[model samples]
Target: MILQVDELGKMHSGKQEQVLFAHVSATIEEPTRICMIGASGQGKSTLLRIIGFMDREDQGQVLLQGKDRSKWVPREWRKQASYVAQQPVMLAGTIEDNLRVVSTLHQSVFDEKLAKRLMERAGLTEMAWSKPASDLSGGEKQRLALVRSMLLRPAILLLDEVTSSLDMHSKQLIEMMLMDWHEEEETTLIWVTHDMDQARQCSSRLWFLAEGTILEDVSTVDFFEEPRTQPGRKFLGIQSVRERKWSGEGINYV
Candidate 1:
């Protein structure tokens, strides 16, 4: 398996303990594209954080490439498996300067040609590269963060609503770029998205999370056509309602 979460659990110690997830076990093997869908305040981001080593689980083990996560140095492990947060922060410099930071951190030669190609693919103009990163819009920052994360060519990428801020055109561009990259590499993708259409397009499997646990894990085909759990079915039903509303089909039922 590329990555494995074995009975992993996380909890917060507030006035009343909040268990984010408990006994959550999942395996990501090969270059499978897995889309995680859940309501807000669910543990989708929390689970991604644990897998990326950004947060520690209360119990259970995380294994990467058949070895315990503890065996690998934190930095090296993170380089191989990276996480892109929902709200990304940019450095206080030009776009090119921000992209160049990857080379400095990785001790690898910067690939300017590849950077230029990626920028074009991401719909970033040359002029945008010279502008101060702080001046960019939310969508621009989101794309810049994606570019930075992908530059490392991580083996496993954990994306938490990475395209949430972009317009439809930019969103499509980034999705195309990412799908092309996935097709050309042996990287595994675990994307958390509320956009069901995007999930259907990019993922081969769907994982439904609710109430501090994974309610469903199935192939994308089965997820939409044959959801076994009530939560999975309900989520799909909601998506259907939204689609209908968007298509001007009046909804008579709540």
Candidate 2:
């Protein structure tokens, strides 16, 4: 296994203590695409944060490549399992500066040629690369952030709705870029997306999370065709209704 979570537990302690999740366990084998879907506040992002080592778990262990994540330095852990948030922050600089800064990290070297090619694939014009990154559009920033993550050459990529606010063109381009990046046999993807169609498009496995636990983990085909659990069925049913309504086939409520 590439990564393993052993009874991971996280809780909030404040004026309002909240138990985000308890006794949650999952395994991520190498070189596979897994999509995590759940309603908002169901701990999808929380789980990703824990996995990325951005947040601490109240309890449980995170193992990477058969060793505890604690055994690896934070920088080394991040270099192997990188994360890109929904709202990516762009530093005060040109696109070139932003791309070049990744070289200072412990991961992959800065490849100007590869960076330019990635920009081209992401539908960014040469002029845009010279413009200040802070002035770029939301979609453009997302594309650049994706490129930055890719430059790290992480073994596992953790994305949390990275393209949610993007236009269709930008969304499709990002999806394509991610797919191309995962063409290698050593890279794994753990994507957290609310878009079911996009989830199906990019992931081979679907992990259904509800009430702070993974209710089911199955192949994407099985998830849609034959959901095993009631929660999974209900989730699929709701999405099906939404899709139908979107197609202008509203239910005839007599």
List model 2 lDDT by residue over 89-174, tens digit each: 89789988889877876545688888887888877856466788988888778878888877878889999898887889878988
- Taking all chains together, the TM-score of candidate 1 against the true structure is 0.90
How does residue 50 of candidate 1 score in lDDT?
84
User: Estimated TM-score per prediction?
Assistant: 0.90, 0.89
- Colliding residue pairs in candidate 2: none
Give lDDT tens digits, candidate 1, residues 1-254. 79888998888544268787888888887888899998987789989988888988899999988888769988778778889888888888999889998888878999888888888898886546788999888888888888888888889889999999999998999889888888987678899999989999999998889867887888988887757776676777744555567766877656
Cα deviation of 119, candidate 2, in Å: 1.4
Per-residue lDDT, model 1, residue 236, is 70
Stretches off by above 4 angstroms in model 2 are 13-15, 238-254
Q: Which candidate is the best by TM-score?
A: 1
Backbone clashes in candidate 2 total 0
Cα miss at 188, model 1 (Å)? 1.0
